[model samples]
Target chain A: MTTQTANIATTRTGFGAYVLALTVGVALLTVSGMAQATVLHDAAHDQRHAMAFPCH
Target chain B: MSKNLLSSAVFAGLIAGSVAALLQFLFVIPLLLEGELYETGARLHFLSDGMTQSEKGTPGLGGEWDRHIMTVVFNVISYTGYALVLVAAMGFAKAQRGLELSANSGLIWGLCGFIAVQLAPAVGLPPELPGTPAAELAPRQVWWLSTIIATAVGLSLIAFARTGLWQIAGGILILLPHLIGAPHLDTYFGVAPPELSAEFVTQSLGMAAIGWSVMGYFAGYFLSRSED
Candidate 1:
């Protein structure tokens, strides 16, 4: 019973970690996509236009 | 443990992104290029003096290759990011509320995502053309972010809340941001013709709606398959 509980706990921890990573990854991608920094803006320029986000 | 979820989101993002890019290439880009011509003074909407003006030549494929490639790559990446967020939200809903995340249901979820992320906020701030002038960016960004969060939370409550009171609260949340209003300029200052701007806004939103629907369906489909 103790072993089974430990296995379940480990699975939950692993799942939590995966979720955290995904959240961070997506957040970073979104920020960079919207960032005003020259390189990032240029990289995402076409997308910014395509999405109709305000770009001068 | 939830590796399948991540993989499924990636797959859905790729498919949805490709679809969106193709649609934009076919429909949106031409309008955008035409708008740029007006912005650059190459294309005049109406003559200031009573003189017949020659039509401007169409922009050729000169240095747009690099930009075009970047657009495809960025579209895929951004859509994939959006899919990740949607899938993560779905996972949370399933874990917490015992909600089923199947393809058909994903369609609804995707539409909700579109409303929260695109449609609702767009009510105040319609899509702008390349040369369109606007208010300060910082305030606009703040309003946009707040509106998206409020709408998302409001929508989830409406969908998942069991009580009528909670549903009413959700409705309030959805409307609160709009009530506050999005930042806007006192005067309209745009170089592009009003008709062109209006058309751009409509086309942009229409494309977005389609993209969101496709992404939602595929994300849900992949997640359901992964479950099995």
Candidate 2:
């Protein structure tokens, strides 16, 4: 393949890698968020609002 | 693209996501909570009768780790959303052009995500800790500055290092959520406190952007080094 064509091929391959990585990253983020929801809710929840920074 | 290249990119994404999540969890949250911004903002909200704290508007310290976990959880949710968007974008683009997503690209992408998603919604939502009277607009401002600075530094490292394409993808993965936007209180209130509400959206979006950039840089480094 010509030099430019080779470069294009390289880029395509790299782009594919990026897409796949993005998929996995999303999955991890989702799971992590779910794992910490309870803690976030407890610390910042409505009932505790008064103790923290009551808005109303 | 070859299987090796694809594998590296995927690996980079995972690394970037994780790093971004950790930074927010371990560093950003604590800084915001401890800084004067929190107190000043909270005080403003308290004055406005905007918050309803159990302790008569006292901003309690819920252990340092409490904030840490909150940051972590938030980052995770935000990053996950970004990843989904990336997948869709890639599918639509249909033409893979690069082996690795550059660090600078990741940061630029992050800014795009923040503006499109978080900054827009913040136009109506408050930034105070929910149920608190504290205005928290100061901290929100700080958040914006911090996000920009952090993303710029992290993405630059990735771009210059030439580590791998995966890191770039990871950055993009973290960024997508900010671009897509997140849920806020604006949907409920008609005449919400302007400053507070606006700050809230911007801050949330900014945090996500920072996390994504960090993830992208770290992931790129890790995956690029791995022989697998």
The best candidate by DockQ is: 1
lDDT of 2 by residue, B111-188 (tens): 554443334333323334343333344444343334433443444445444566756754764454346443343343
Candidate 1 versus the native: TM-score?
0.88
Model 1 chain A: worst 10 consecutive residues (lDDT sum)? A9-18
Candidate 1 per-residue C-alpha lDDT over B1-228 given as tens digits, one digit per residue, 9 for 90 to 100: 267567777888888888888887776776677778888887877567945344533354347788777777877887788888888788777767778879999999889988998898789878776777788988887888789889999999998899999999999999999999999999976766677777777887788788889999998999777665
Listed per model, the TM-scores of chain A against the true chain A are 0.43, 0.36
Q: Score the docking of each candidate (DockQ).
A: 0.38, 0.17
Highest lDDT against the true fold, candidate:
1
Model 1, residue pairs in steric clash: none
Which whole-number lDDT from 0 to 100 does residue B44 have in model 2?
37
DockQ, candidate 2, comes to 0.17
Report candidate 2's interface RMSD in Å.
Answer: 9.3
Write down the lDDT of every candidate, Cα atoms only: 0.77, 0.42
